[model samples]
Target: MPTWLTPEGKALSCLEKIKVLNENLTEIRELCQEALEDAVLMGCDEPQVRQVLQELLDSLETPFENK
Candidate 1:
C-alpha cells in the first residue's frame, strides 16, 4: 500500500536504494581516507585520528543517543 510498494515503485525500490547506498558509502570511504591522509600530513597522531573516526562511526550507529 505504500508508494514504494506499487508495481512501478517495486521496480525502483530495493535495488536502486542499495545501489545508491553503495555509491554513497564508497564515496564517503574515499573522502575519509583522503581526510585521514591530510590529517597525518598535518602532523596529527594517526592513532588518535583513527580513534576519532571510530567514535564518529559509533555515533552514526546510534544517532539518537547523546554522543
Candidate 2:
C-alpha cells in the first residue's frame, strides 16, 4: 500500500481517508489490469495499450484546483 499524500506533499493522517484512498487505488489497479488483459486478448499491442492508458491518465483535469 502506498502512503497517501496531501496536495502539499504531507502524508495523510486520517485513517478513514487513508483507507478510502487505498481502496480506490486498488480498485483502479484491478480495473486497469482487466482492461489491459482484454485489450491484449483482442490482439492489441501491450506497450501501446499501456502508453494510451498512461496518456489518458495524464490528460485528466482535477476539478478541485484552486481558482
Give the best candidate by TM-score: 2
Query: How accurate locally is residue 60 in candidate 1, as Cα lDDT from 0 to 100?
Result: 69
lDDT of 2 by residue, 1-67 (tens): 9887787888989999989989999999999999999999999999999999999999999888643
Query: Tens digit of lDDT per residue, candidate 1, span 1-67?
Result: 1233443445446767767767888888998999899999999999999999889888866446432
**Regions of model 1 farther than 4 Å from truth:** 1-13, 61-67
In order, the Cα lDDT scores of the candidates are 0.77, 0.93
Q: Measured by TM-score, how close is model 1 to the native structure?
A: 0.66
Clashes of each: 0, 0
lDDT of 2: 0.93
Candidates in order, TM-scores: namely 0.66, 0.90
Worst 10 residues of 2 by lDDT: 58-67
Model 2's C-alpha root-mean-square deviation from the true structure amounts to: 1.6
Q: Give candidate 2 regions above 4 Å deviation.
A: none
